[model samples]
Target: MLPNQSFVWTGATPGVRYRFAILADAGNFLPDQCSTRWGSTDFGSRGLPGSPGFSGVPTRNNANGINVSWNDYNASYGVQHWRLYRSASAANRCSDTHIATLPRSTRSFLDSSAAFNTDYYYTFIASDLNGVNGPCSSNSAAGFRPGQAPTVSAISVSPATVVAAGTTVNLGVSATGAIPSNTVAYQWRAAGQVVGGSSPSYSFVGQGNHGTKQYDVLVSHPESAFSVTRSQNITVCRADQIVSNNACVCPGTLQEIGGQCACPPPLVRVDNQCLAPTPTPTATPLPNSFPQIINQPQSQSVQEGQSVTFGVVAAGNPVPNYQWFRDNLNPVGGNDPQYSFVAALSDNGARFKVRVSNSVGSVDSNEVILTVQSAPRPLRPVLECVMANNDGTLTAFFGYENQNIAAVTIPAGTNSGGDANLVNGGSILPGTQQPIDFSPGRVRGAFGVVFSAQGSAAYTLGYRGTGIVTETANSQSTPCAPIEPRLACVNPEGAGFRARFTYSNQNAFNVIIPSGPNNRFSPAPEYRDQPINFLAALGQSDHFEVVSSSGGDLTWILANLSATASGNSTPCSLPPVCNAGGPYRVQQGQNQVTLNASGSFDPEGLPLIYAWSTTCPGASIAGTLSPLATLNLVGNRQTCAVNLA
Candidate 1:
C-alpha cells in the first residue's frame, strides 16, 4: 500500500474466528512459496485492546533493581495478561526479552535482574483472550541505577602557598569514583560564589584586596545526583606589600613599623613613628651642571591590545632635553620624557629608557622591560530570547559568540574569575544552566536560566572585556549567525576511517561558505565533499562524512575555525528522537486533524517509539500512544499545539 493508506478487510460474522497476514514479496504469497518468516503471521481479526501507559517515574534501587508501574489496559476488550519486555540497548528493540507475564489486573513489576549504572528500556503490552498481543506502549521508559558517588581525593593550588596580587593562580581537584560512562562536572567557588566552570582546573587572577581567600570545588555527576566539595585557602599580597609575620603589610617607610617591617638605619623612631635624619646644608649651584635622572620608568606587564606608558623625571640646568629609546638603540619616542603607545605582541620583552641631556651632560634612565601577554580572544554573550512561563516566572535563553578558533571556557561568577555574570538588582545569580565551555562560533539558545521576578525587570549580564549587556526578561532579541565546523563522530570504515562533521546556523536565512580558506579541509584537496550551503537554524545538519587514511587526523576548517577528527576520536551519543511535523493549521470551523511524526529518526539507527500529548482545553486525542494521532477540537476558534516524544 502507498504511504498513509490503510488496507480494509470486509464482511466479518459474529463469533467467527479470522486471521490475516502481510507478505513483503509476491513469492511469499504464492501457495508453494508461502513462509511465515517472510513477513507477519498469526494476527487475529478482532480488535486489540488499547496499550497501557507508564504511570509514574521509574526508580532504580540498589540490589533491588528497577521498579516500574503502569495504567491498566482497557478491560472491555477481554484482557488476558500483560507482558513486560526489557532491553539493554535502545537501538536494538528486537533483542528485548520477555521478562515477566502478569495477571490481567497487575499494574506494576520489579525487574530484579537489572545491572547498576546501566540504562535499560522497558515497555508493556497486553494480550487479549483470543491470545493475540496488542501493540506495545508507544514510548519506552528508561531506568538507570547509579553506582558510587564521586569522591575528591585532594584539592591542589599552584604557587604552592601564596601568590602575589595581580598574578594568576591555578587550582585543581582530583576526583574519582563516578559512574563509569558519566562525565563529572566541576564548579569552583570563592567565598560561596561560583568562580569557575565545569573544568577540573581553574585559573584565578588575584585582584582587589589582599588576604587569605577561601575557594572550593564541587564535583558532581548526573548519574547519582550526588556531589562532593573540597576547599583550599589561597593567600595573596599586593605589589607594594610584603608577607611579614604571616600577614600582608606595607613597608615600614610608608608608616606601619610592627610585624617585621622595621625602619632601616639612620631613621630614628619617635612618638610611634620613624623620623628621617635632618638634612645638611650644601654649597650654591654652578651655572652649567650635568642632568640628574630621577623617577626612572618602572617595568610594565600588560595583555595584548592594552596600552602602556613609560615616563622619566629629571633635574638639570637649562631644562634638560629628553628622548626615549627602545632596546637601547632605536629611537621610538619624540623629544619628551614620556613615551606612550598601544602594546603589541612584537613588543614583548623589549626594553625602554629615556636620555635626559642639556648643554653640560646627559643622564640615561634605567631600562625597564615590557612584558606583553597574548590575551585570549573575547567571547561575546548574547541573550537570544526570553520566554514567559505559565506560572508567572521568566526564562532567558542565552548563547555566545566565540571569536577564537578553538573552544573557550568561561567560569560562572559575578565581577570576577569568569567570562560573564548575570545580575538582578545588584545580586548575582548562579547561572546553573549557562554553558561554561563555549563551542567556537555562534550558538543560539544554547541554554536558559530562569528568573522569578515579573513585569519588566531588567537583568544585566556582565561579560569580561565587554561591558554590561542589559535586557529585560521579556525582551525579544535577534539571534546571531553561522556556526563553526565540528567533529561529530568517527568510526572505522573498512580499511579507511569515516569522520562525520556538523554545523549550526542560527540565522533565519541560509549561509554559504565557498570552499577556500573559509571552508576547506586541511592537508590538500580542501574540498572533501563538505557542503558549502548551510540551512538556517535547522538545529544540526543531517551530517557529512569524510573518509581518510587510517593514520593522520582530518581537520575541517570553516570560517577560520577548525575541528579535527580521527579514528580514535570519541563516538557520538545520539539523543532520543522526537519529530512532530508541521505547525498544522485548520479552518475556523474544522475541528479535527491528523498529525504525523513518521519522519523522525535516530542517527545511530535506533528504533523509535512515539508518544503524543497536547495542551488544548476541551480537546481529545485519538491514537495518543502512536506515531500518528488525530486531534479533535470541541469548539470553534480554539488553538493548540501537539507535542511528540
Candidate 2:
C-alpha cells in the first residue's frame, strides 16, 4: 500500500499479508491511471504515471503515490480497546489513510478524524501487548443523543385496618416507575364519602347515624395510573349500660328498701329513700352521764379503804340537775355526773341519795345504800379522765371512746378491792396505767383504778374528800414527807391551774422568793422541752406553800423535789386540783369557747380553781386545763341554748 507496484510484506508475520486499494466509485467508474505500478519501470522514470502507486518503504519512492490497505478484519471477543481506520482513494490515499486508537478502556470509537459529512469507511481492530493486531471488528454507526425517563414503585399504608374514632392514619407510598416524587398524590374516601386531594392514605371517624362505617384510600402518581383504594371496616356504637337481673336501680336513683336499694340499718327512710340516720335526738338516760347508773334497790356493801364511785340515772324534761348526797350533803364538792369516795370506812353508812331537777319538775333518785367496812386503803381512786374536758355525752354516744358502761370492757387502773394483787403491787391512779385484771369493773357507779406501785406503802389516791376512810396527818415527830400540790386559779377569761411547790429554805433565814421558774409551756404535748428555770431565792427551814393568786391560770407542778438543805421537813397546804370538762362543747347553733382551770392546781402559781360554766346543758368535763378550748356548734338552731356546767 506504500505506493509499491509489487506486492511486498513490510513486517514479519506468518500467513498474514495486507493489500491496499480504494473503490473510487461504488461498482462503477475508475479514475485514469488508477492501476499504475511504482518501482516496476513500466512507465519510465520521472514521467507522470497514469496511476497512483505505493512509495518510500519497500519499492522505489515516488511522489503523488497514494495507496490504501485493508487488513483482515479481526474480531475480538473480549477486548475492550479498538482502533478505527479509513481511507479515501488508491495510491495517494496512503496519505489520506488515518488511524484513530480508542482509549484502552474504550470499546468503541467514531471516525471523526475523517472529514465531516463525507462517507468515510471505518474498521475496528484490536491491538495486543505483543504488537500483533487482530482482525477488524464490524463497523457500527452512531451519533450523540439524550437520555431516558425515571421509574416509581412501592406504595403502602400503615395500620391498614384501624379502629374507628382514631384520629388519622398514615399512608406510606413508594414508587420507582418514573419521577416518583413529583408524580405521586393520594385520594381518600370513606364508604362513599370522598376526602379531597391525595395522600398515601386517609382516616375518618365513622358517622354512625349517617352511613356505613367503612373507609378506603387511593394513591396516585403522574407517571402511571393511581393505585386501587385500600379499605377497612371499623365497628362503632354508642356506650350503653346493660342490666341483667332484678330491676337494677335506675343509674343513680335510690331504690326502695328490700328492692335492691336497701341501706344499712338504724337508718330510717328519708326523702323517699334510705339514708344515713341524720343527727337526731338520742336520749342519754336524761342525766347525759355515761356508764349508766345502775340503781340498787338498797345499800351496797364496800370494804374499808376501797373507794366506790356511784352514778344515778333519772329522766325528765329539760334535763335533770343531779346532786349526789351523803347525809343530805353533796359529797366531793360539786354535784356533777361523778362522785367518788377514795377509801371507805365503817363510818360510811348504807344510805346514799341522788336528787334530779329539770325545768318542768324535780325527781329524787331511789336511796342507794353504800355500807362501808374497814379494809386496806387503795393506792388511788377511780378517776374518769379525758384529754380536753368538753361535753361529749350525747354526740360521742357511738364513738369508740364514749362512756358506754356495757362497752367499758377494761378497768383503767387496778384496785385491791376489785381483784387479787399480784406480788403485792400498790394501787395506781386512773389514767396512769392499765389494770392487770381481765375482769372489768361493775361500772355501775365507778371504773376501777389500776395498781402500779411496788412498795408496801404504794397507794392509789384520789383527792375526793368524801371517802369514809379519813385522812390522818402524820405526827409532828414522824415528820411527814412533803408532796407536790395541785392548785386551781381563776383567770379573767375562765379557769386556770397551777402546780404546787414548797420553796427551799437553804439559807436558814427568812428570804423572799420569786415563785420558782419561768417554765415555758408547749401548746402541743408531744414535744416536752426542758422547763425554763429562773432564779428564786428561798430561806432555810421555812415552811411556806406556793400559792396561785390569780384565777384559772396554768402553772408547772413539781415532778420531783430536791432541796439544798438536809432533811427539809415542812408541811404546807396541799395543792388544789380540778378536772376539766370534755373537749367538745354542745351549743345551740353557734360555736362555743370552753374554759377550764382543771389541773391548774399549782400552789406556787395560783390557789383558786377556774372552771368553765356554760349555759349549754350538754357541757361535760375535760380532765385538764388549757389556754383556751373552743367548740364549733353544729345541728339545728335553738332559741333556748342549754347552759354548760
Candidate 3:
C-alpha cells in the first residue's frame, strides 16, 4: 500500500547543509544506515538568495547631491531591505562604506553627502528577512555633484572701440565651477537695465552719437545665492574717427598734422582735400607698314573624321583681313585668320595658304599640307592549302590576309576572343601553329598544323570589322600553287580602248619576273607601267593598261600563265578612293619610319580597311593593325615600294 505523509524538519541552521534518510521495512535503522540519502547538500541548501541582477547604474547630479538608480531586486527569497555602499575609488571595493539601508521596494537613492567636483562609486546588495546578505551587485555606478556658485574669471569686449555708428560691439563673460546639471545663468545689464538673456555674450549696437558705454555680465547658479559681476567699457566713435587711449582721434589714413587732416608726402592737397597723383599719358601710334607674316600655318596629319585648322598671324597698318585657298585655286575660307574643315580622302594631298591683306600690301603664307588617315579594318583568315604528309598524317597550311592598310593582330589560342585559332571538328587543335601578327595582303603558308589523316582542320579568325569567320580544310582540298596571272578587263578610253590586267600570287613571298620571255606583253614594248615585282596574294596587282586605237586585243604572259584582254571582255568597276600618305624620305641610317593612311575614307562613311605592302627587302613593318604603321628599315639605300589596299 502507498501512503502520502508529511514530515517537517524545523529550526534547521540557516545556510547550513543537511540530508534526510528513510527506512522502507527494517526492524530498526538509523538515518545513516539508509540506502539512499534524500536531502543531500548537492540538491541545494537553504540560503539567503542569489545575488540581484543590476539593470545598469545611472546617476544624476542635483543641487543637494547625486541620485543613483538601479533595477529592483526580485527573488524567491523574502527580501526585507537593500544595502547601498559608496566608495571614493572604484578599484578598492573593500574600502566601500555602508551608505544607506533602503526598504525592499526602493531601487534608487540620493547621496546628499556627495561633495561638489568629487567622484563617488556606488553599488547595491539585497538582504533577506533573516538578516543574511546576498552577493553584491555585479556593477558599480559613478556620480558627481557640482559646486554651488559659478565663478566668473574674466570679461571681454571685442572691438573695444566702435569705428562707425550702428557698429555692433560684443561683450562676453567666461566662468567655471558649474557642472552640466547646474543651470548657470548670465545677465547682461547696461545702465541698470537688462539688455540680453541667459547667454554668456551680449551684442551692443552703437547709434546716433559717439560716446563711452559700460556693459556688465552677472554669472550665477540657480541653486547658489552668490553671483559674480564683470564690467567692460566700449567707446563708440564717429565714422570719420577711431578710439585711441580711451578717446576718439582722426582715422589712420588721414593723420592730424598741424591740427588738420593731411595726406602723406607724394599726395598733394587739392581744394583743401588730399588727392591721388595723376596717371601717365599714353604714347603716340607709329606709322603703318606693309602686311608681314608673323606665324605661318603648320602642316598636320590627322584621321579622316577629325578636324584640321590652318591659321596665319600678320601685322599691318590696319588689322589685316585673311583669305584661304586650297591648291592655290579655289577660295575655301572666309575673312578670318584661321581656316578649319573636316578632313576627307580628297583633301589628303591638297595644300592650304592664307593671304593677309589690308589697306597696305598683302602677303601670302607658305603652303601647308594636311594628311588624313583611314580607319583600321578587320583581319580575315584564309586556308591556303592542305599538304599530305608521308607519315599518313595531313599537314594543313593556313594563312591570313589583312585587307587593311595596317597590320592586324590576332593572338593565338581559343581563349583569345576575336583572335586566330585552328580547330579540328569543334575543338581547338593541340600544338597548332598560327601567326599572332598578320601583315597585309595574301600571306600563304604563314602557319601549319599537323592532324590525323582522318581529321579535318577548321580555321577561325576575326577582328573589329570582320566579326568571325571559320574555314575548314582536309586532304581533299587543292594542293598549293604559287602564282597566276589574269586580265581583269578592257574599257573604252577617250577614242581608244584600254586593256587592264591583274594577277594573283598565293605564295607567302613576292614573285618577281622581269620583262623578258618569262614575262612579256605581245606585239610591242613589254614594259608599259607593268609591275616587275609581283606581290604575294590576290589583291597585289601589276595592273597595267595598254591603249589600242585600232581596236585590238592585248595578251600578257608570265612564265606558264597567260591572259588576254579584249574589248569584248567584262568592264572593270570604278576604283574606290584611297590615300597612301606619303612618298616619305628618311636618312640613310634611319632605323625606323612611320607610315599613315588616315586620309583615306569611304564616300558612304563606311569603315575602310588598311593593307600595307612594301618592296624594301629586309625591312619589317609593325603596328599593322592601326592606321599608323611603323616600318623598321634596314640601313640601306634601297628604294622601298609601299602599296596600300
Mind giving the per-residue lDDT tens digits that candidate 2 earns over 34-58?
A: 5433443222111111211111111
Q: Write the per-residue lDDT of candidate 3 for residues 276-379, one digit (tens) a residue.
A: 88877998897888899999899999987789888887899888889999999999878999988898777888899998898868989999988878755666
Per-residue CA lDDT of model 1 for 441-535, tens digit only, reads 89765555556534433434444564555555543433234456767677776665777787766655444454655567776432268886666
Number of the top candidate by TM-score?
3
What TM-scores do the predictions have? 0.26, 0.17, 0.34
Predicted candidate 3: what Cα RMSD to the true structure? 21.8
lDDT of 3 at 573: 65
Off by over 4 Å in 1: 1-84, 87-144, 243-278, 285-645
